[model samples]
Target chain A: MSRLAAVTGIGQTQYKSARKDVSMAGLVHEAAERAIQDAGIGWDDIDAVIIGKAPDMFEGVLMPELYLADALGACGKPMMRVHTAGSVGGSTAVVAASHVTSGSFDRILTVTFEKQSESNAMWALSIPRPFSMHLNAGAGGHFAPHIREYIRRSGAPAHAGPMVAVKDRKNALKNPLAHLQIPDISLEMVMESPMLWDPVRFLESCPSSDGACALVISNEKLASEGPNKPAWIRGMAMRSETMTCKGRDEVNPLAGSDCAKDVYAQAGIKDPRREVDMAEVYVPFSWYEPMWLENLGFADEGQGWKLTESGETEIGGSIPFNCSGGVLSSNPIGASGMIRFAEAARQVRGTAGEHQVDGAKMAIGHAYGASAQFFAMWAVSSEKP
Target chain B: MRDVAIVNYRQTVPVRDSGPVNELQMLEQVIQGVINDTGVALEDFDFVCSGSCDYLAGAAFAFVEGVEAVGPFPPIKESHVEMDGAWALYEAILKIRTGEADSALVYGFGKSSPGYLRSVMSLQLDPYYLTPLWLDSISAAALQAAQCLNSGTLTEADMAAVVARSRANAKSIAASQLKGDYSVAELLAEPTMVSPLRKHDCAPISDGASAMIVASPEKAKEWCSQPVMVRGIDHRIESSMPTLRDLTRSESTSIAGKAAGIAGVDVQFAELHAPFSHQEILLQRALELDDKVDLNPSGGALAANVMMAAGLDRIGHAASMIQAGRYTCGVAHATSGACLQQNLVAVLEAAQ
Candidate 1:
């Protein structure tokens, strides 16, 4: 028999271009302390600490968790650093929950961050590996061709990307911690923005930000004793495939579909669109919103764009998404995924102040990384399974 | 918790440099080699986890390229850690206990020769306080050695003897990076490379990869002729501040060892990830290993210090010994951060 796990508290730093005021330790500490305080517990309540980040090069610090141990109140406790690229945030939370499910620890503190301001992230990401392509564009450049293929395959309308960008920015107006809160966000403004990667406009892409996210996860026993209502973790799953494998579809990735299937199966959900009240999907690019919709089984293949055109993904719609502005409005790289997970929990707990989906019963949190090969996702609900 | 056992282990010969071979090529060889030893197909493993540092490769998402080694075509359940492979093993064990996976493939690799290992490791320190001072790893370790010496907790002879035994025991292993029949007195006579620590006192900078196959107890018995069961495993961390920790002793290791139930076990041999000579002594005392324990039978990291892979190598080496019937029970240790701020201890026993 496995022990149930729940998210008792969630915290995140204000996303920004540069967090110059705080060092890496201070940044993570800020989020961790908030989560502890929100949980109404002291640092001693945490049994272990798990941290995740995209890469050490982003902060020019190799395994910054070593330095962060003291700041996180992790001394004399077990600590592990996870690095599964952008999906690290989701995977790190999954690992923390698994520790509780394994009956090893009662309360676990999990955190993920990326201090992009510390170093030039574009340069760090574009470093030429031996025997690989040298004249490569950064992450956007690598994904542009794939976006073009997705457009070609789905035959999405020209206005779909602009429409999704405008929707997320509009939603950002409600999230005070969001990095990009454009007051006059509109489809016309997004279409007028310069195109950086052929079909993907500059406004459609996520901004580089420095931020951290933290969660206080506890076993069922401890969770029952917590001060606030808990978001019960229904299911969690992670999957990966090679960057270049035979017959792999980068547009509608198979790894992502498999991950969604596994997570939904674990949660005993047959129809995701009807069961999942809201979703906090990782939409780094505006176009990804529709593409992921089909991959996640929210809509049939070649029909996801219809949902976007109908505006059903907007707040107060049938299936609201990016209620917390999602990645397009604020991308802290590693913390982006955890922010989505946290948003899902917040909505379920009825604590999502401005952007709360009314009476959200179940929510989905998803993230992908590394040429869309790695996928991590989880399902959280207000009611225990 | 479910019973898990390691059934197969493999590692590349540690060398000063891997040249233009690259991380993917090195990892592929170990992955294929471990599969051959186990006689099990890659698709049979329920999960995969690897340990690597992208900083060593001078690129972000460098570990993503490592997926090519396993030919992840249909996709698989997997995870990666920006730490030593031993921690990856720890995660895999938890996956099995939680019934997430019945088996897992754990691997780690690093090429430290391309960059100055000491200066590169300096980046791992506290950036605001230590990195600004540009304190390299050797100097940091030398400070630890100086404190131990000044406190009368260790001596030059004790340090030299550790290196001498490592050299003598490692001479027969083909994967040994540095080995010879040297006397403790001769090692002591050599000029100190950094204060009280000599060149031999530190582990050599090596490039290598290691892999192991682990499965649940029932699956292990069905798949392998010999299996080494993971009896207990635990890890603990302390302050990153070198000044705050007791340099003369490893308090974190003691806490981890006790949590792993290292006490009252008939551990005949041990494999420790101690890159420095004094550290080996410090760890032995912390874990309460007496003279009966055969320390560093494979010369430990002193024989082949392959950064991210060495910690996993210690666990792999210990499991191999148990498989060979040379030892019925043993302990394997892995550590990270400055002066062993974090430590993982795993107690292994041969299947009866």
Candidate 2:
């Protein structure tokens, strides 16, 4: 009953520790303008705009979309703001797709960003609430325990985490816009890095960067006629659970699993390992690469680390993952998820210049947040369903 | 478009402060109330969405705590907006129209009592320009009222009449925080709190939460004997810079009203979310509504404005009136940003 939708354009600002060259509106405008240009459409063609960010506290602005309406050319148009924590970028894209798929609008421009330079994400995230103990130092401290639990349950080798860090960082060399471009990144270098969180080393964690990502989505008719090849959206889904609940499995969250199942079902994918040509998943920490591989059904419950250790996740391997360097290389918190989703679209559209997976016909994009209780995933293919 | 209707709606009484009852507890009560009233289990909802502001709670990821209200043990499909609950309902309508969901639970909450509500709202301005000025919300509205009065569009008595009518209507709404009968002459005699605006003209800072259950036509019939159909809904936004806009007129409201097909329907009664009484007058003229159309029958925002939830409350109140057979068709309006820069309009009608 739903109309088909596809991604006709994608744009991203260069990831950096601080985008001092541009203000918040200017940063977002850079990406939105690029996306609109890539889509070969004018501002008048867009029916609506949807923007997303991690939290207002990150930049000390409440409902920033209001102020940003002019910059994004959303004046006199339907504008919306979505917030689902770190997964907001992906969720924002899904909502934009809904604008087309629901037959409400023909074209929608979706944008997400985070200027962490404005404030400290660690302090914003770890603010002490009344009556609640503030034992967690930050996101790293909170997620480090879960990563350790995954190691204890999976029996992953000590080198597994370091290997992932090196692989992702090495991939960053091919991505010009990646925040971190360490040409000499190696397994030994990652292992020798300071141990920030016990099982997570300094090199294993993501960076706090300021950046923005944008996408232009349209219905089938306009998409087919667009100047560029469209990445047809096969399926999209979002799921969430309480942050902490009785018998919650933080390491292998059910919400992540259920989200993958729902998207795969809609995409008609029976075996994701075989059907999915590539993936760009949220791996803020190196350990999450394997944790999500298992949670997303790419490997058996306890065998996800084996896939990584086998070197099968490399670009020339069976299934290339995070070929764009992923969140580990460039994390703009709010835009991290959409960066994954955009990378997937690039692969399927044969537009990923240096990191393109050979003949990638189908790909998956995934992101999670809030103690791993929220999950958002989408499947895109070169061929229309 | 799918025939989505409001089957059940619930709200907690607006109060000056919730005290020990935190945001989660206030939202939980409303969510539970809607579920119990509609006899629909929590898991029955195909999707759940909520709207709230992090600044109101003065913390990051404050909405995460609201998830506990649904008891999401099984992990449900959900999304959230930083806008108002009316926008959450818009997302639900899109989901249902796409066949991704047949039923959705939408809610919004905010507690403005803990902080200086007026000063807290200034944070919504342009960070590089207006935010540095710390121009609070009240002063912003007062500026708009001055423009309206200077233009000779409306007098102080006209604004007072909106307050007088709102107070009289609040006598019927149990959730209303402020209610009293007063003539326009009596209201005009009161001291002006913000130059051109009186204290009664501004919406009371109240803490509350509201929830609504919307479903497809089939599910609506199965859930409730009386359902108010959402005829049409649309929202629009103008420039954020106050200097770029005409504060005397709500252009966005007029655009959204036309897009929502208000001209095609004979709206009998209406509920409008205008934090300030002068805004109600601007919105009425923007929507092109005549005096025949009843406005703010539930006292509107001036009586009990619950920040993020007040917009949805307008739609909920209008739907409730339709269900009660007070009128067959009505229009519900919600506004955001200073001087009604962003606006949403929804037309609700009883089942024909």
lDDT of 2 by residue, B1-352 (tens): 7778999998999999999888888998999999999887999999999999988988898888888888898899999999899999999999999998999999999998888999999999999999999999999999999999999989999999999999999999999999999999999999999989999999999999999999998999999999899999999999999999999999999999999999999989889999999999999999999989999999999999998999999999999988988899999998888889899999999987
Each model's lDDT comes to 0.90, 0.93
Flag regions of model 1 displaced more than 4 Å: none
* Candidate 2 CAPRI category: high
Q: Worst lDDT window (10 residues) for model 1 chain A?
A: A129-138
lDDT by residue (B91-185, candidate 1, tens digit) is: 99988888878899999999888888899889888898899998999999999999999999989999999999999999867789889999988
Q: Which portions of model 2 miss their true places by more than 4 Å?
A: A132-135
Q: What's model 2's lDDT at A133?
A: 41
Give per-residue CA lDDT, model 2, range A280-374, as digits (tens). Answer: 99999999989999999999998899989998888987877899999999999999999999999999999999988899999999999888999
Residue A260, candidate 1: alpha-carbon lDDT? 97
Which stretch of 10 consecutive residues in model 2 chain A shows the poorest summed lDDT?
A: A128-137
What is the per-candidate TM-score for chain B?
A: 0.99, 0.99
How many pairs of residues in model 1 come into backbone collision? 0
> Which predicted model would earn the best DockQ?
2
